[model samples]
Target chain A: MRIRRNLAGWMVIALVLVTMPALSAQSGKVTILGTWGGHELAAFEKVLEPFEAATGIDVQFTGTRDLPAVLTTRVAAGNPPDMAALPNPGQMLELAAGGHLVDLSQILDMDQLREDFAPVWLEMGSYDGKLVAIVLSADLKSLVWYNPKEFAARGYQVPTTWDELLALTEQIARDGHTAWSIGLESGAASGWPGTDWIEDIMLRTAGPEVYDQWVNHDIPWTHPAVRRAFEIFGEIARNPRYVYGGTTAVLSTNFGDAVNPLFTDPPRAFLHRQASFITSFITENNPGVVAGEDYDFFPLPAIDPQWGVPALGAADLIGVFRDTPETRALIRYLVTPGAQAIWVSELGKLSANRRVTPNAYPDELTRKMAQTLVEAEVFRFDGSDLMPPAVGSGAFWEGVLMYVGGEDLDTVLEFIEAAADDAYTSGAATD
Target chain B: MEREGASPLVHLVIILTCLVWILPTLGLLVSSVRPAHDVAATGWWTVLRNPFDLTQYTLQNYREVLGAAGMGRAFVNSLIITIPATLLTIGIAAFAAFAFAWFQFPGRDALFLVVVGLLVVPLQMTLIPILRLYSRLGLAGTFVGIWLAHVGYGLPFAIYLLRNFFGSLPADLFESAFIDGASPLTAFFRLALPLSVPALASLGIFQFLWVWNDLLVGLIYLGGSPSVAPLTVRLSTLVGSYGQSWHLLTAAAFVSMAVPMAVFFALQRYFVRGILAGAVKG
Candidate 1:
């Protein structure tokens, strides 16, 4: 009898403890989930401070590396957060198709948003003719980083066209130095850097229309356009004289550490093709090196003049699941120039908002990169992120590895095409 | 039993195996103390070129990891989750094992078979269903919910191991105790409990370490709420999503490993004996 009474008392206590949070969650609060942590999370929190002060709505943020799995489970359990910052549009499209996301066109001011954001940003964030997600920050990937000091000392000019780039590579090889340092290894995502190479080449050579068709699997993996992109990449990657330590080093070196050779004494490599974020790694490995002076970037030289200097990049998209008043208020605040300026200045990321001027960036190099992003004549999202996972992350990654490891290109293309056929067909059937 | 000494070749092989196992851990230890720039710029083995250069080492990584927001609270939360989960599983399994071993009850054999069968069910399979139930009960992010979940998942193996250990005890001891007019409760408390100390100690270590190192259960049930998250969850968030602040991971990993290493070393003597407890009849 005593033990039973004790258990009943504890049950009462547990009930009270569990109900407290639910009771306090009535109004004036919004919860968000995302994959940001460390300094990124801190910057996001700083951006939230003004909103919290003005609206008096409490914003609770949850950080996790496994956002997709957690978000799916939460949505399945009928308890999704008010908002979530998706890493890519692929997952957002999946959730929006399932009718789990709230259409932002109903909640946000469309005319104001259109004026602040570019058409490409809005188009990427829309699905089924309704805006469902919004992008706040972007990272430019079509860049070729080189040491300005070395280039000037060696009397080499920055290439502006594909022919000029080839001539520069040959000249550098003749000068008894490697032309490029390409590192494709990123742990399990090893060959993604190589995919970026192909995507950039595709945008330059075949134009954005074909790139979109290619990403959607409208064209088979064996198309001449795709093969041509691969062949162009091969000219630099397969030539022992053009790459730093031959194809073997390109296969083994980590993407983050690959740029260290460019900063070493008597610099082993001249040019590195990577995203704008590579500057962080360069400065980290070599302290006291100034950006824009010690190192600078030029656009990956145009392959076809018709396509012009196209931009290829990735961005973080924020989408809503529960449309409450506080959620509406917070979403409105997030896209404003006031909020975006703080976000970009603190984290050194490029804001997609046109109202956010270059002065919001921390350094001149970042301002230049932001300008490059905003001024591009043509811009497209990263191609691999748009395809089905079986081909994008699975076959495409492995195919690159096999191609670099000396497999025949024909066999590699066939392997990826087979996987794409299965993935896209089954993916459509499930939808 | 008497044992023969190993040959020189066996000794050499054992030494080589030990070296291979210890090399990575040694490198981690060395890297954890070095500055961030040095760690990224050169290999850990390079520090040995000037071994006495005390200026080459710093405790900044450890300081930063320990000082990161919510990490101290997370350490306490880990203890709060792990200790009770470990104790509850051991305590409940002990009584249940005693009942299955000595008590004459209806359907006892069938019940034991059912529990041993539960060991085959994967933990991942039950996460969503249990989470659904937990949400309905308003226990989704509560400490009590996680404790109950851990106990439920741990009970089957706990009972299997303890029942085997308790059954392997001599029947003469229980008979002698009952002959002396002792109740079943008294026999359980005074006889079976004392003799099963080694098995219990080993089981306690296993349960404690499993709960301490667990990430998925804590992540799913706790829902990334910083107030209830454990050390493993907090450590995972110390780096950026793309793993930008990876220089801090070596230190963060070492911090989480400290408690488990201490617990294992303290309770290691009974581990081997516990493994062999039920295998032999004599």
Candidate 2:
């Protein structure tokens, strides 16, 4: 009778233990909000799956392009997601300042991250002396794409300096082919390409300190350095002879579609300037053209050759909104090289983690770009993203369109300066 | 008689107007079938050049959209939302509308004046207030939260359309029923509802479409849980705002439109007859 009682007790213990995991799983789920979707979303899930399997932590991802607006609604309703992968450093800073973000230093060995990331990347992730975000993926924007086959067949070589680059562009024009394909149209954000041109030129001509000061509006929009940057952009953008269709086509064509002419028979245009992400569009449009063999990229040719290589890049920063064990674990896993290698290999993305080697990249061009990003002497976040939206997205974007449409440079500069004055002064009051 | 003399011109005008409306939808349909690369690289009109080349098209987009993991649950959520919201609006609007048409009471005109004025209060103005109220009442993220929201927003125009129809019905019908020992409740259930089907039917179509196509309200209240999201939300997440996969968007657009199109066709007789009934009375 004692043995029978023991058997029944054993059965009861088994019943409780078997059902325990199922019950606990319900409450342990962590929700993440991000803007990456489609193939990018698929890549992210693939990268994070191992962590989920290892820890039995269910991670739910929700994506939306308008992440900031959605996050505002959620936070106001007191139902913020457990973590959010923010698209820019400026937005991360805003959330950090609002007391909505949890400090990563409390839960993470942030000093260890110093070994993984470039110092500038880490600085961008911090707000008010607190590490609030860890960057996941980066896109390098200082690339100029060209048809290497056309270059080789014509006995041409890649330019190594700004002057040589200009001469090559003129030579291409002289050959009765268009030298550059430039498009600024992007629907509501129609003038962003113009901003990139100015930012890139500013980095080359004025150096990084002035570039930083200009972005912060520590220097005025009308300053000579800023004007010179605009003038250099105009030399290419405003000239009808250098551009593929005309100066007018620069304002009308969609940025992605601008590269299509480069792959046409005899190659309609020989050169295009865009971020590295344009590879997907180029390969998709021209199915037979192989990367590195048909098309290639080089960093924007140096102007002064003195201050160092200033590469403009963008990264998605993930911040913890709640100090939960699940979120902390996920953040830790994300920053590790093993997890980052999966993302880099799948999406052709760059990792801020130093241990994620260039060999993790999908192709030779991407591998080289990754190495360049890591080894660059100077790097800066996308300038428009760093400024307030009122000036950055509103007046600055609009000013580019006006300038491209033949509005005088001073008028556009004055227009943007007025907006910056209001945005910065109003921001100071809020602080 | 004059319309007969002008008939050919009228037909021409109608044909041109209809062409303007139908062309975009035709383009979307053509785009939905083209390959993802072609949709991005070329115009849909390019199909006209090589109409016989079936290799240029595929059903892959539709397969992806329908086979998406969340679609089945989202389809159910949409039904759960739209059906109840439509029924509730018709039921509540019918009662409020009937009372305004039949009853004699103090400040009746003022109350109705307020109800009509409420029609001008946009849905954007109400979303935040209702969200706060829903959270306080523990209705946030539940099916009932969005259902109540649609009903509230849908009521004003619903009552207005319905009240006018009920008011236009001959007064002698309700009176005869009342005199024959029918209570106002009895008259409402037996007499008023039967004759109001055409009006209610059209109103049902309107309410269903409004609730089905909604993204903002669903996103705000339902919290993107696959268990509670609708098709519009699911499809929207397939394409981010910064970049679009056009072939998927076009296919998803058709998939979401399919149900409303079916509902419209099914209820089209009542839709046309109701408009005629209202128009003939005037």
- Report model 1's TM-score to 2 decimal places: 0.93
Mark the regions of model 2 whose C-alpha exceeds 4 Å error after superposition.
A1-25, A426-431, B1-6, B275-282
* Candidate 1 residue-wise lDDT, B1-282, digit = tens: 334567789989999999999999999999999887787667899999998999999999999999998898789889878977897798899999999988998999999999999999999788888888888987787788998999999999999999999999999999999999999988987899889988998899989999999998998788666667789988888777666667788898899999988988888898888877677765
RMSD of 1: 3.1
Q: Give all candidates' CA lDDT scores.
A: 0.87, 0.83
* Interface Cα RMSD of candidate 1: 2.7
Q: lDDT tens string, model 2, A1-431?
A: 55347657755654553354335446577878888777777888898899999988888787877777788777766767889988888878888888889888788787788888878778888988888998888889888999888899997689888888899989988888778999898887788878888888889889998988888888888889989988898888888889988878999988878887788877878889998778877875677778899889989888888855678889989999988889989989988999989988987778888888778999998998898787778888889988998877788889988887889999999889888988885432222
State model 1's lDDT: 0.87
How well docked is model 2, in DockQ terms? 0.21
Local accuracy of candidate 1 as per-residue lDDT tens digits, A36-135 = 8877888998999999999989887777888877888877776677899987788888889899899999988999999999888998889999899989
lDDT, candidate 1, at B148: 96
